[model samples]
Target chain A: MGAEFVQFSLTPVLIGVLSAIACALPGNFLILRRQALIGDAISHVVLPGIVVAFLLTGMISAVPMLLGAAGAALVAVVLIEAVKRLGNIEPGAAMGAIFTSMFAAGVLILEQTDTSSVHLDVEHALMGNLESLVWLRAEGWHSLLDPSMLATLPGELSRIAAVCAFVVVATLMFWRWLKIATFDEGFAQALGIPSTALGLGLVVVAAIAAVAAFDAVGSIIVIAMFICPPAAARLMTNRLGHQVVWSAVFATLSAVLGYVLAGYGPFWFGFEGAVSAAGMIATVSGIILAGACVFGPHRSRVGVAQQEAR
Target chain B: MSRMAQPTIATDHGHSIDPARAPRDTALAIHGLTVSYGEKPAVFSVDAAFKAKGMSAIVGPNGAGKSTLLKAALGVIPRLSGEVYVFGETIRDARARVAYVPQSASVDWDFPTTVMDVVQMGLYRKVGLLGRLSGPVRAQARECLDRVGMADFANRQIGQLSGGQQQRVFLARALAQDADLYLLDEPFAGVDAATERAIIGVLKSLKDEGKAVVAVHHDLATVRDYFDHVFLINVRRIAEGPVETTFTTEHLQATYGGRLAATHLDELAVADGAR
Candidate 1:
């Protein structure tokens, strides 16, 4: 039983660590831009896109599902922007309305779908099964690698690799422009930087990252992965570069610990061993965020008192 | 026009003379410039010409649209009508040569950034995509900080600085841009005397380097002392010319007469009632 638990922990730990790192990269910019809630919104709203892709393709391919989900997320952003521009609504109000409405629409679409071959389970969507991911395998790798190595690469490995690669390339390519736009949009415009393009690009990257993490972690868990790590790191540091590095560290640590705890937690508690790994990881991230909220340097009661005295 | 043809005005400050320098060329020309906030006009139609290189002060009563006029010139605010020309070219063509120092109050000081980081933002223009800041950019940023006496505080967070220091840091950032035309909005609004002097000295040096500077100024006493040219305004351009001529009691009456008269009568009436 102990050996079985250790084996089950390995895949969850690896996925959790990689997914946490990927989420942390864009997490810094998302929190700084004050669009942290958009991660939650995108994660929830992408369900309909996932369902539609599955219905048409008749297969659960990561690429098509992600692409479709990205399209839907962009539409949501456009709707929010239109609400702000045409209706003269405040940004928060517009974002709140668009995200909730789209999320409900996605849930409604899921309920109406008649296909049983491809089941879109709410529990699975809200809390992913990291243990089963160990057995899954992606094809075509056998041609490129030795059979032994190919066999070792889990099916979910390809998905995680693709997500990481996308995050790194996008972040590096737009680092300077993103920095300028994040710091001051008006000033960036004055300097001839295309602030609007940079902003929209960030939103797309954010949506992609959120959706990519959705299956590894559930939609709700993706929020904790995307927001809590960054928020904790931001409380500790002011420099953008340092914040990104620290956030990655915090996220990876939490993922490993959370995965280990999820695997053994059932044995100690005498409960059903069916608790979701993604949910546990998210819970760990939430604990970290809450601790940082109380003890973090920026708004901590102790820190504020010290500052006041000084 | 000959350099000697222009009149020079002497004031308490011995260097208050126009220096009788011939206007090099028309750097900026404002014709019928009108700016409004919603339906209410902040700046009425006004025509003016700024010399290629000099310190010009925009001064008047409260709600005189001084900052609004500067914002209009910078193309930040949409103008109701009319046009602004720089070096005989429209604002679009002249943006590369212009720098702006927004009011310190316009931003949240608590924003997470250091003074050097703020100053480095000035190089965003010169450094295009994939354009890294060369050694010269850093050197120039340092030089601007030194010019404003903020060199030592470059690495300090902006929030740690006082109001005066914050204002100086902003000036340093603008200086780093190395633009030919500068529009500053109330640089001395809440600064200390030393900081105010430092800013005025920097502006005077910019003038010496033949850079046109239009500053939204509040202190009427310093208008004649600090500026070579002055524009007295209310909702519209009341008068704009050499400080010696335009800073007259008549223009002051026309620009601030309504409020000043009301206050004077209220004081007199109070005195009579007390008696």
Candidate 2:
């Protein structure tokens, strides 16, 4: 019975953790570069890409969704760049103008296309149904090693894992270039480091993470993890490495705690079923950020201690 | 007609450089360098060159394109038309040997990075991809920090440092590069007097080591004392030569234009005269 419980509940939890870590990994760079909104923009714009891919392929696989989302993200980025360049406007204005149009276009695509046949729907895209993914094909923990159980393992977990691994390897491998370019771009350029290439690589990584999170969680959860954990971690530590580590911890905690609260909290309140797990996770991360902003080690204490001194 | 490039009559002194002294002796060369901002020109046909060794100050009043000239010459900004040669070669070849410290205001100080992290950036090209800061490379970074007296603050986040300290840390980062030529934009701006002195000391040391140093300096008062060579700029080269000979009252008048007589500009002229 214990083994069955572990086998039954592990997939959803693993999916949540993997998605959170993936979102948080790239979130650090986005926050550091002050391009946090780009993450939000990418997450929103990817909706149309997924819907379009569904229309074209007539199936909801990982590759097509990722490809469509990546394609849309690339277009969004290119349009943002073009808007900034041709109009000579700030990146913020360009991001707003382009991303909104892409998101609206996505909604239009969803309305026009017969998307009822696809397993994914607008609601699932917004705040994924994590509860529906916990159906274990095997009865015991031994099923993890069983070929049939392994084959039937929840697809979302492995997809999130692949994207998470890519984020980790890329972050570690290109860490030096990212650090230099982010802190002092002119110096990095003068040193002949490919700052422009590094910047684009970061954007692509963010898009990949957004797409990965979109399946098990949603764009809302993706945006929250992309900005909140990194931002909260920023307020908590002076060192960037520590900030990244803290961000990962905060993101994982929000996912774990949020999933449990979402699955079980309604029972205590006498409500039927439960709330959206993605929504709950985002809310928890938001709360964690607020707490950090007010009580984190590097933040607020300076002002409070000064008042005491006076 | 003065824009004419004569092989023999190099503008080193009062119109006589030995013909045998090749143009290769020139550390940096900017020929017909012009920078435009849309319809208007910021710096026009600005021609100046620095020798292989010694400290030269690019001196001018506000809006004189002193910073613009550096940017255009280094290809940091788009030039309307210009050719910059470093050590008789293009900037691309001499990139690894050149270090630039932009105006301190250009940097975002609140960036989450340590002083050591910034210093390590200087070695990016030398280390290349997949190279870690292990053994002697780490020691080199420390030595560079020690030179700027920012060794103790190596682990400290850069945002917490003072303006002068930040400037010193920038200098340390450039020092870690161990480059042959240095271009600095107002390193002394808003720095404490001690920092100014220390920065001047470092510039002189670099000069002593036969490394070319060019700084965009605002204070004309210390031109003769601090720099061996000076380029008096106001959209164009007003004058360029040994500070004692070329930095005259007329050049200051030309650089400042109408702002010379009515303001404290005359004080800088008088200070140089007293020196």
Using DockQ, give the best candidate's number. 2
TM-score of each: 0.81, 0.90
| Regions of candidate 2 where Cα sits further than 4 Å from its true position | A1-8, A300-310, B1-23, B36-39, B262-266, B270-275
Candidate 1, B-chain TM: 0.84
Task: List each model's interface RMSD.
Answer: 3.5, 3.5
Per-model DockQ: 0.22, 0.38
What is the Å distance of residue A205 in model 2 from its true position? 1.2
In the range B123-171, model 2's lDDT, one tens digit per residue, is 8777987887788998999999999888999988777777899999999
True contacts kept of 2: 0.43
Q: Candidate 1: where is the Cα deviation over 4 Å?
A: A1-12, A52-59, A115-117, A135-156, A268-274, A294-310, B1-24, B30-48, B59-72, B75-84, B90-93, B219-221, B232-239, B247-275
Q: Give Cα distance to truth, residue B107, candidate 1, Å.
A: 3.0
At residue B40, give the lDDT of candidate 2: 80
Candidate 1 residue A81 Cα shift, in angstroms, is: 1.6
lDDT of 2 at B135: 84
